[model samples]
Target: MGFDTFGDFPTTALEADQARRDAFVADAGGESIGVDQLHRVLAAKGIAGNVDLVAGDICETVPAWAAANPDVGIVLLHVDVDLYEPSLVVLEHLWPRLVPGGVLVLDDYGRWEGETRAFHEHFGDDPPPVERLPFVDATPVHVFKR
Candidate 1:
């Protein structure tokens, strides 16, 4: 499952930077501008049925989804929310539901201060060791749930 607003950029930080959005659209070859584009891509890749793309604010959608599906255990969570409050909300609601040994990937970790701070604040003094993958523009970091 994935959560996104799926229209204009959601945060002020992202909205103020049109270049970043433009670059992403360009990088996607103009194929990822909206939810329909994502659906088409997933359909073409033959995995549309396997993925659930939820459209809404993460802070609202995540908790609502979790409440509706109480038994689900997330094995892998890829958080690319890019802002502090939403990132923290996602962690607070979902982290406990992540199964033991599950992996959490924080996209935009090193590149965005908000996300980086959210990661640190969410985990506090006992933050799990995260491994930064080389060769990724997003500078994503991942850690396994213990």
Candidate 2:
């Protein structure tokens, strides 16, 4: 499952202002473009049924989804939320659901200080070793659950 507050910051005014200041929107359509592209790619690969996209604040959606799907164990979690609070929320809600040997990918790790700080803060002092993947735009890091 994936969570996002799409459109021209339809969630909150504060978030919209922040997005404008940060120039966070990749296209004119905002995050909806990314969501659409993801769907298109998934459909092309014949894996559209495997993924579910949730539109809302991660802080609210993640916990709600977790409670509703108690039996679900996440094998791979790819988090691209560029803010600290949401990143931390996703980790708090989903990290425990990740089974052993599961992998977690932080997509905005080095690109955004908030995201980077959230990862470190979530893991604390005894964080697992992360492998940084070489990418042109964002610095993504991954770690496997022991």
Candidate 3:
């Protein structure tokens, strides 16, 4: 399961590995999805394949989906595009879905204070048997493995 605020996508043009994704949906789906009015656009253009598109609060959705799919492996819980509360709520919910040895990666993690604090508190000096990998660059990312 994946979770995000849909504020903005990492890329544009919608090509290559993610080509199967709809450009409009990937870029602006969040706004439409959040409004609970994307079905028209989806049906008009055959965009249901990406039914993973959700229209609710991440905190509520992530854990619900995780609890239901105990067999799933490697669920990406991306929370960079939203406010701190929703992101934290969602992460708290999704954390349990990650099977032992699975990974949780955060994009633009080092750029925001709220996100950084949450990450640290959740996985402090001796975090739940997980390895921390912080990459530096224009868009730094943090990866935690359990």
Note the Cα lDDT for every prediction shown.
0.74, 0.73, 0.54
Superposition-based RMSD of candidate 3 using all C-alpha atoms, in angstroms: 10.1
Candidate 1: stretches off by over 4 Å: 12-32, 137-140
Structural similarity to truth (TM-score) of each candidate: 0.80, 0.76, 0.54
Q: How accurate is candidate 1 locally (lDDT)?
A: 0.74
- Model with the higher lDDT, candidate 1 or 2: 1
Worst 10 residues of 2 by lDDT: 8-17
lDDT at position 18, candidate 1: 43
Q: Across residues 1-146, which tens digit of lDDT does each residue of candidate 1 receive?
A: 97887765454344423455456556764332577889899999999899888887787998999899999998998887667667888988888888888888887776666677778888889987577676666554565454
Give the candidate order by descending TM-score.
1, 2, 3
TM-score of 2: 0.76
Which candidate do you rate higher for lDDT, 1 or 3?
1
Q: Give the higher-TM-score candidate: 1 or 3.
A: 1
lDDT score, candidate 3, position 78: 53
Candidate 2 stretches with Cα past 4 Å from truth are: 9-21, 26-31, 34-41, 135-140
RMSD of each: 3.7, 3.6, 10.1
User: Per-residue lDDT for 44-96 in model 2, tens only?
Assistant: 99999988888777889899999999999988888876677788888888988
Specify the poorest-scoring 10-residue window by lDDT in model 3.
9-18
Best by lDDT: 1
